[model samples]
Target chain A: MPQIAQLAQTYASQIFWLLIFFGAVYFIVGRGMVPKVLATVEARENQIAADLAAAEAARAAADADEAAWRARENANRAAAQAIIAKAKAEAAAAREARLAAAQAKIDARLAEAEAAIAAARDSALAEIEDVAVEAAQDIVRRLAGAKVTKTAARAAVKEALAHV
Target chain B: MHQFTIEPVVPFQFAGYDLSFTNSAAWMLVTAVVLTIFVAGGLRRELVPGRWQMAVETFTGFIDNMLEANIGKEGRKYVPYVFSLFMFILLANLLGLLPLGVVGIHPFTFTSHFTVTGVLAAISFGIVLVVGFWKHGFHFFSLFVPHGTPAVMVPLIFLIELFSFMIRPFSLALRLFVAMMAGHVLLKVLSGFVINGANAGLGIGALVGLPSFALMIAISALEILVAGIQAYVFALLTSLYINDAEHLH
Candidate 1:
């Protein structure tokens, strides 16, 4: 074979060039470029990790803000409820006082009206008795043609009124 | 065999040596230049890599992972040499199979030469030897004798281990050289049949030439697969051998 025949002649050149070119590849590619590529990958990974951490921090801050807002909302609602309750209580007390005062005034007026009615009935009975006495005396004098005293006529009228 | 002949492109001599710039040396230069361009193109170092960068990264990462698996942390230091070796061989193998013959440029597979492969194997073996001695000193010789050996069987086992260890470089070189040379020879033989059959008669051409042509196509595909497999095998064995040197087991 030519490969075997030419071995003695060509071996030196082949080896020499192989070493030179292979050495070039080793230095240029392996030492020169590989480290840079790996570094880029590592840097990218670190950036991703940092971004994720930042996102987590922002999310936590948002959650804390929401919690604070909820607490404030709850406090304001409680304060409003207390004010409503106080206003309702004050209104109830004021209404109660007004109702009691009006009731006391109505009771006094009702009592005065009752007393006036009683006095008017008493005066009317006394006036009716006097009239009846005078009428009885007149009737006696006209029928018998005798004069009758006021006191005796009043007493007789009283006795007859009583029997009647 | 004429395809395999080495013709000097620029003749030179130094210290009584025929160190001429031959076709083999030219192809070696081509492989180096092409590889450099491929790698340099991918050196954009973008956070998001393009297809070219991805291709380059994939190959480098492949070698890195293989070494990491085989030799652990210390394997990282040998990445450049192994990566250079792998890409060089792989490109040389594939460049040989390029159907550029129609354009009158018959690519030479320099790996088909045993001398070229022998040197590559020697380099790997040399590294193994250097690392073994440098790290473990003379204790590296203890690799020939396995642990828990029967006293009577020690000599025999040592002989066997020593023989196997010694043949590693030869085997490495022979495997790649034979594989590449055989594929090319087969393809050449089949093409010969196709040409001869067609010259002889239409009947023989239809019978032998047609099937051979079809087989040539199939074998060409197999050759491509063999090219990749051979390169991977070389790198893997080298790393495994280095592992032995590093750990001495």
Candidate 2:
């Protein structure tokens, strides 16, 4: 009871100090500490957002690069296929030209061999005609005592070759 | 008995008022000093907070969340006032419970006096009044007259509402002051028993003294909890009152 009654006497000092202390605490915590804590929180939030954004950008860039590389690879393969097709065409053309040249040389050699055989056969036929003419003249002298001409013998042999 | 006594550390008078600095004032200074060191020392810009910084952050966040939950985002402007309110009262309560004379001085709680809580409550009530008028002008008076009341019941309801409104400061002050004062007094009484029992000699003394001492310790722990909760309740109500004034519903 006495304490309650004495509250009047004590109030002035208590309030005075309370105001002073409370004011001091308010400034220190309000001006000094609260902002720091808020700043830390804000900074963390901002950093997270930035990191996520960077990661997204990097991923996008990587995807683009991969797509470009794939495109280039496809293009190179197509180019290689075109070059192979062209090379095959050139090789076939070269092979065709060489084959044609070989066939022409074989045809020329066969014509020369046929001409030489024809000349030898003609010479043998001429010599056989002369011999036949002489033999015919000698046989007539012995059997019938009649002479045969070389022209007639040759003509006969030619007609016979034609018929055979 | 001397625990409740107010002795002036430096006796002075000004304008017929006892402006003398006393143990209560000294403890306030002590509380202020400790709070300054605790808060200001933790203001470093650490990416990962140290212990002191973490403690400071936790307290700020707790009050911030409480205000936001109770009063909405508009209550953020009152952070300094509410934060200081919680810290000062909480420290005063805890400091009062510290062992006396260990620091070669006796300390008293400012909150144990009705005057301290009275001032805080008055401030809270005053803010509500000023903000209510400032925001709504004459419309603030409508706070007492709820909508849809019949004409005959208006006066009666108005009187009741006005009475309740006026009781806010007194209720807030009494709740904190009485809790702190009574708990301290009860601890003092129990310790008195223990001392007396010890003085009376061995057999009956042990039987009375030990349990009394144990009970005192238990009560002190409970008082610590009460101390924290009371501070929280004070700030919470303050914010709620501010919200009511702001919204008028």
Candidate 3:
């Protein structure tokens, strides 16, 4: 019984100290820790926003540079194609002019062959007419028996007609 | 040589000053461990709570409902402190019934001691003092001086009121410790009768023993009731203190 009475005195004191510990924690929470945590969170969020904006600006600049490079590349390609076309046209014109010159030389050779053939026909016809007339006059004189000595017989006939 | 019968080991003391890690402290630590395990187990956050979770929920909800009914909207904010305070007292009281030889000086047992209970009272008083001042500021001082009193009676009223106010923690501590201590002593006294009768003779011993045992059982039951009642009184007073602080009354 005495033991029980004594025990009561002991336990009551322990409860007193626990409350002081809790009170201290409550004060620290209100005064400092909560505000610092909130400030850190706000600062982190703002930093992320700024980084994102800077990244977007850099991307836009890169896109514009790429577009300008592409336009110059396209112009270079078109100029190269035009130069090729012009070189091809010049080659075709040179081929045509060479062909025309070869054809004119061939036509000049054909005209020369025709002129030689016409001259040969005229010389042959004159030689054939002279042979035919000589033969005919020789046969006629052999049949008639009248000796006609060319200029001399003609001169004799003229003198006899004068005397008559 | 006579064989010695050594005294049993009490709670450890340092340089003749016992830290008084009494039965109440042991029980309080046990309650803390139990709460920790229970909370940790249910922390999985399942859609449907398990049996253990449900039990903890019942206790938390019971306190929640109490705060709601007693202090209304402003009461809910005080749930944590009230919860800790109630558990401490409840464990301390229930631990007395443990067969681990608490009534007989074992390492772990609920002891009816003013030191433990008084500490709890002082804590509550401290909280009341600090929170009241913080909430109500200098206006809280007005409670000591009642309104509409005659100038002649003011001095007398103020002294009485101050004494009564000072007694809040003292009375609260005394009330719980006294009831537990007295009840256990009564049980001890009743059990002694049966032992004394057996030494006299079998016939007288059996006659006295049976009834004495029955009386002991009854006292045991009453002790259990006292335990719960004292714990409730402690917790209720804590909440009332909180309420008084909140309202500046």
Candidate 4:
């Protein structure tokens, strides 16, 4: 066939061009273009990874801040509680001291009043003894139709008062 | 028949070698220029690539995956070579299908020529052979020797394996060339029938012409598919061969 016959005439140029063109394509595409594309993809991946990491770090920082605030709040509450407890103790102590002072004053008044009562009782007893002595003397004179001495009547009344 | 003709534009001869710039050579140059522009233009560093850039990326990825799958990650180095072969063949096939065959200015049926396919095949085979030897040295001969073959069957198996290895290039080249040539020829023949039928006065001629024209359209679609398939097959085999060379056994 002419096709088979034409092979010899055309083979050289075809082969030459094929090598040249194919080699050119290989170098331009393989060495040049491919690396750039791969780099873009890699760059994107790295950027995404970095962004996610930053977000996580920010979240962690927020958590730490929150925890610190809560701790501070708890510390302040505890301090307030301590102050209230201390004030209560101090108030109780003051109340007790005042109560003790009032009791001391009342005790002193009670002692003075008891002393006054004892003196009054002694005076009253002496008055009653004199009255009794007079009565006894009058009665004795009427019965026996004789007069008794003041000293005797006084001594007799005293003895009767002592026995009663 | 005229499509198969290779008319030399600039003729030269040195030591009995026909080193002429033929129509085929012109198309090759055209293909080279077009491919360079495509590769250069598609080089965008943006994260979101444009259509051209995406196409370029997809093309590279396709070859990359093919190499990795067939030949392992080390096969990555052969991406450019295999990618070039695929694009070159694919473009040549598609260009041949264009209506430019009438003017003959663009001799686009370059891939349909056996020499063109043969050269590509030979190059792939050469790489396989050279790399096999270079990587393995004298031990590359062991590629033909089947492991676990009995002593009695060793000679037969080795001869068969050696022959199979040698014919790989021819098979690759013939498969592509024949498919392309046959498709083009059939399309040509069908179109001729349509033209002849429509020219022969009205009624029955138009009826006969319409079906042939319809059949040509269907064949054209099929040819486009074939062009893609042949290109893929050529590149896929090249990668596979490279795999065999690189990994051995």
Candidate 5:
């Protein structure tokens, strides 16, 4: 093979160039560039982690705000309910007081009407007795041509009303 | 044979040694330039990388993972050398297989030459030896003696293990060189059949040329796979060897 035949002649050049080029590759690529790339990877990872942590903090804050808002809303609802119940109880008490005052006035007026009716009835009875006595005396006097006394007639009318 | 021949582009000699700039050397230069451009494009340092940056990271990450797996945390120190070695071989192998011959450019596979592969393997082996001696001193020799051996059999086992250990560089060189050279030779031989049969007659062309052409296509695909696999094997073995040196196991 030409490889073996030319080995003695070509080995030196090949080895020399190989070393020179391989050394260049080692220094330029391996030593210089690799570390930079790895650093970039690490930086990206840290940035992502930081972003995620920030998002988590924001979420927690939002949840806390919602919880506080919910508690305030519940307190306000309870306050409104208590105010409504108090207003309802006050209205009920006022209505009961007004009804009791009206009942008392109605009872007083009914008693006064009954007393006035009793006095009118008593005066009307006395007037009827006087009329009856005058009519009796006038008829007796016209028939016998004599006058009648009012006191005696009144006493006689009273005895007759008692008997009737 | 002509494909394998080395012709000097610029002849030079220094100190009684011929180190002429040859086609092989030119390709090595091309490999370096191409690799530089590839890595340079990825140095944008954007947090969100583009496709080019991603491609570069994929390769570096692959090597990093391999080293971490094989040599543990200490393997981090050898990243530059191992990364360069893997990328150089991988690019050189793939560049050789580029279908540029149609444009009258016959790309040389430098890895096909034993001298180039031998030197690469020597470097890896050298690192292993230096690290082993430096870290463990005389105790590095005990790597040859497996744990829990019979006292009488320890010497024999040690000799055998030493022989295998010494042959590592040679084996590494031979494996890459043979794999590259054999694939190219087979492709060339099959192409010869396709040309010869086509010249002979249409019937012979249909019979021999057609099948050879089909086979060349399949083998070309397989060669691409082999190119990647060989590069990976070289890097993996090197890392494993470094592991042994690091821990002396």
Candidate 6:
């Protein structure tokens, strides 16, 4: 194996330059590079913030749309409920009017029926009185074998009333 | 022909591995200790940061930026490891350049060996591999497989993907080793020439060696830049490997 001394003797000059190379990169990077990266990160963060703000605005808009839809839905429900109540009130009024008219018609029919019954009753009473007078004259003629005078008729009417 | 020579200093074998408590190791130890102290004590944290804190933070921030830019934010996770690696390499390379004529003592640049850098590269690759498996599970292995094609094309695509996936370790190891070794040898040979010329004659050596010295200086500057660049690239690629894991195939 080649000795470390021999190798070092031959290569001393080369070692020197390698050292120079390391120095330049070190100085430049420490001073220049890191700051640039930090700036970029800061810029990125700012952009993210802006994007989030815009997204929040969009979310708020969506919420507003939902609220509007709910409000319209509620209005429709209220309108429908009012219409149903109006319809129900109208139906009730119509039903009450129909019942009142039917009752009036029935009362008029009853009154007409009552008047007809009263006329019939008067005619029947006159017929019954004539029949009764004829019956009484026949019965008296058979019993007495002669016509009854007005005073004797009154005496028999009183005797019949006293026996009843 | 004159013989080339350098005197050996401290040498011993402590562990199973060949150990040389040479100048290189000394400098490496110094670098490690200094860094530990600097981080622990210098950055000993307060409510607000101080100058030392700022310096450490600056280094960390500098490396972090480079990784993010080159490999992207996915690269940031490797920052701690990369930072430590950079510190060690930077200190080693710079120390290697320092005037080490303090008495008879010399300084060593830890980056001289292909094995040293190769191991670092290999370790980095290993980390990438582990992460690939850790993050992606068996699917990372399937990075070798092609997707969204007919069953007829699957075999050919799989072969291609396999080759690409296999090349990562080789590429990583080569890039650092070659750059470091090549640059060092060039500097040394050129410096050797100047020393020879100066010994020959003062006037002629000044005339002849001036350009060599200038070349050495220019090359030195370039090497400094290259050293830092190589470390960054190593860390950057490591992060990319991590990213590959994250993304999978």
Best by DockQ: 5
DockQ of each model against the real complex?
0.53, 0.41, 0.03, 0.41, 0.56, 0.01
Per-model TM values vs. the true structure: 0.82, 0.78, 0.55, 0.75, 0.83, 0.55
lDDT winner: 5
Ranking by DockQ: 5, 1, 4, 2, 3, 6
Model 1: CA > 4 A from native: A52-164, B150-152
Q: Which predicted model would earn the best TM-score? A: 5
Q: Show model 4 residue runs off by greater than 4 Å.
A: A39-164, B101-107
- Summarize candidate 3's per-residue lDDT along B124-224 as a digit string, tens digits: 89888898888888887667777788999988887898788789999988888788777766776777888898888999899998799899998888888
Q: For each candidate, what is the lDDT?
A: 0.89, 0.85, 0.63, 0.84, 0.90, 0.65
How well does model 1 score by local distance difference test?
0.89
Error of 6 at B151 (Å): 4.7
TM-score for candidate 5, please give it.
0.83
List the lowest-lDDT window of 10 residues for candidate 2 chain B: B101-110
Q: How well is each residue in B162-249 modelled by candidate 4, as lDDT tens digits?
A: 9999999999999999999999889889988888887886875688888988999999999999999999999999998988899887
**Over the stretch B1-249, how does candidate 2's per-residue lDDT look in tens digits?**
577678788988878888889888888889888877887766785777799888887888888888889788887878878888888889889998888756777768878888889998998999899999999999987898999989999999999998999999999999998999998899989999998999999987899999999999999999999999899889988998898898898
Per-residue accuracy of model 1 over B19-61 as CA lDDT, tens digit each: 8888888888888889888888878888778999889888888
DockQ result, candidate 4: 0.41
Interface RMSD, prediction 6: 10.0
What is candidate 6's lDDT per residue for B1-249, written digit by digit as tens? 011122234655443433444444455556665655555443344434577655766676776777677567677777666776666666656666565645654555556555457656666677778888887788786776656778888888888877877777777767765676667678778888898889999987898789999999999898888887877777677667666766764
Q: How would the candidate models be sorted by lDDT, starting from the highest? A: 5, 1, 2, 4, 6, 3
TM-score, first chain, each model: 0.72, 0.72, 0.51, 0.66, 0.68, 0.66
Report the lDDT tens digits of candidate 2 across residue range A102-135.
Answer: 9989889888888988988888887877776677
Q: By lDDT, is 5 or 6 better?
A: 5
By lDDT, the better pick of 2 and 6 is: 2
How large is the C-alpha RMSD of every model relative to the true structure? 4.3, 4.5, 17.3, 5.6, 4.1, 17.3
